[model samples]
Target: MCIFCKIAKKEIPAKLVLEDDDLVAFHDINAQAPIHVLVIPKQHITGIGEVTDEHVTVLGKLLVAARRIAEDAGLSQSGFRVVVNHGQHAGQTVHHLHVHVLGGRPLAWPPG
Candidate 1:
């Protein structure tokens, strides 16, 4: 199983932030920002395109969840950024699709 799959299954420990039947959010072990959260689908999918219409509702909910997490993390007032690394070259280390909610400081442009 992939590390994220292990995390989803609770076979491995994660500093969980939010969780439900379809998705889970956790603090990245190697956080890039003060409030770096990784929101991932419970049902592992390789990438965004692999997600179907059946996933549309959950994807919407996921975005909502990210906002909620941002508010909970006190980033609502300051604003935040959301990111999804689509494939290997895009910087996705884990096979599971995920959204990254980050904030708590000034972020650079052109996220290279």
Candidate 2:
């Protein structure tokens, strides 16, 4: 199983922020911002490239969870960024589909 699948199955420990039947949000081990979190679906879907019609609901939930986590972390007023890296060239280290919630500081335009 992938690392994210292990996290969802409770086989690996993550700094959890939010969790539900279909999704899980946790702190990024390698944070880019003061408040950086990763929101992912429990069911592995590889990455955005693998998303299909059936993955729509879970994909939406990932955004919802990212928003909620940002708000709970007091980053809603300051603003936050939601990002998804689709492939290796996009800086996607993990194959699992996940959303990056970044905030607590100024983010530059045309982010990499």
Per-prediction tally of clashes: 0, 0
Model 2 superposed RMSD (Cα) = 0.7
lDDT of 2: 0.93
RMSD of each: 0.9, 0.7
Task: Work out the TM-score per prediction.
Answer: 0.96, 0.97
lDDT of 1 by residue, 1-112 (tens): 7788889999999999999999999999899999899999888788796988888988998899999999999998889999999877899888888999999999998897
For each candidate, the alpha-carbon lDDT, in order, equals 0.91, 0.93
TM-score result, candidate 2: 0.97
In candidate 2, which residue ranges exceed 4 Å CA deviation?
Answer: none
